[model samples]
Target: MQLVVGRIGRAHGIRGDVFVEVRTDEPELRLGPGAVLLTDPAATGPLTVESGKVHSGKLLIRFAGIKDRTAAEALRNTMLIAEVDPDERPEDEDEYYDHQLIGLDVVLTDGTPVGELTEVVHLPYQDLLTVKRPDGSEALVPFVSELVPEIDLENQRCVIDPPPGLIDLAEAELDGGPEQDR
Candidate 1:
């Protein structure tokens, strides 16, 4: 499967090195030198990592034949994708691949049906789960260990401990909105 490794940001310097926003936790394994990455726009290129370094916390990478800042700038916003093995997983148990969470049933602790886990949004700080409800609407639930206490892969379910207003639609519907005058 093709997994996103990093996103090419603006050109870092005049030497063809571009700043990268890493998506994968295993940067050394996925974005290291000699690693080949596929591009998103379909034309920029299937870039090969010539060199990589951490500059002021963000990753900077140089690709073969990209000789100047202008060349690197052309690759801005390109997603670097890497071919990954299906059996491979992150070493940390706390970490989860997006594929594992997709399609799992989302439910409350009391077994109240919330929705179906549809997508995982990987932000810089935290991940968010997009749960599609039976009514066809989606809710953005923060994927935190405390709020999302369990993931039963065997049973294909995710248990959520939602706080007030977390799922606004459900909260509104359940409460019938504000008191209305007859």
Candidate 2:
């Protein structure tokens, strides 16, 4: 399996080092030094990580053959992909890869069918599950333990405990409810 590990951000300095917006949970392993990453456009390259470091809480990495600011700047917004084993699981049982959660059935804690998990949105602060409802509408459910108490991967279903109007709010936003008036 190929997983997106990070996106190249602007050049960090005059050197070839560029900031990386990490996407994977195992950045230390996936984006570590000497690791080679494939590019999205497929022409930029299978760049090899020559060096990496954290500065000002941001990850900065330098790739082999990319020795100047111009070279690094050209890689901005390019996605970095890594090959992963299909059977490989996270070290922590509670943590799940985005691919693992994408196809599960979504339902309320009471067993009421809600939707199908279509995507996992990774934000800097939190993650969200994009659920495609039976009615063909979509809702963004926060991927927090309190709201999503159980992920029954064995059964291929996830149980959610949404607060009042949590799912409705997403629908309303799409349909222009009273919240839109204010």
> Lowest summed lDDT over 10 consecutive residues: which window, candidate 1?
173-182
Please tell me which predicted candidate would have the highest TM-score against the true structure. Answer: 2
Give a tens-digit lDDT track for model 2, residues 35-112. Answer: 999999889989999999999999999999999999999999999999988778899999998888888999999999
Which prediction has the highest lDDT against the true structure? 2
Expressed as tens digits, the lDDT of each residue in 1-182 for candidate 1 is: 88888899999879999999888879999999999898998698789999999999889899998999999999999999999886676898777788778999999999999899999987879889999989898999999988899998779999999876677655655665453333
What value does the lDDT take at residue 27 in candidate 1? 93
TM-score of 1: 0.80
User: What's each prediction's TM-score?
Assistant: 0.80, 0.82
**Which residue pairs come into collision in candidate 1?**
none
Question: What C-alpha lDDT do the candidate models reach, one value each?
Answer: 0.89, 0.91
Candidate 2, pairs of clashing residues = none
Task: At residue 21, give the lDDT of candidate 2.
Answer: 92
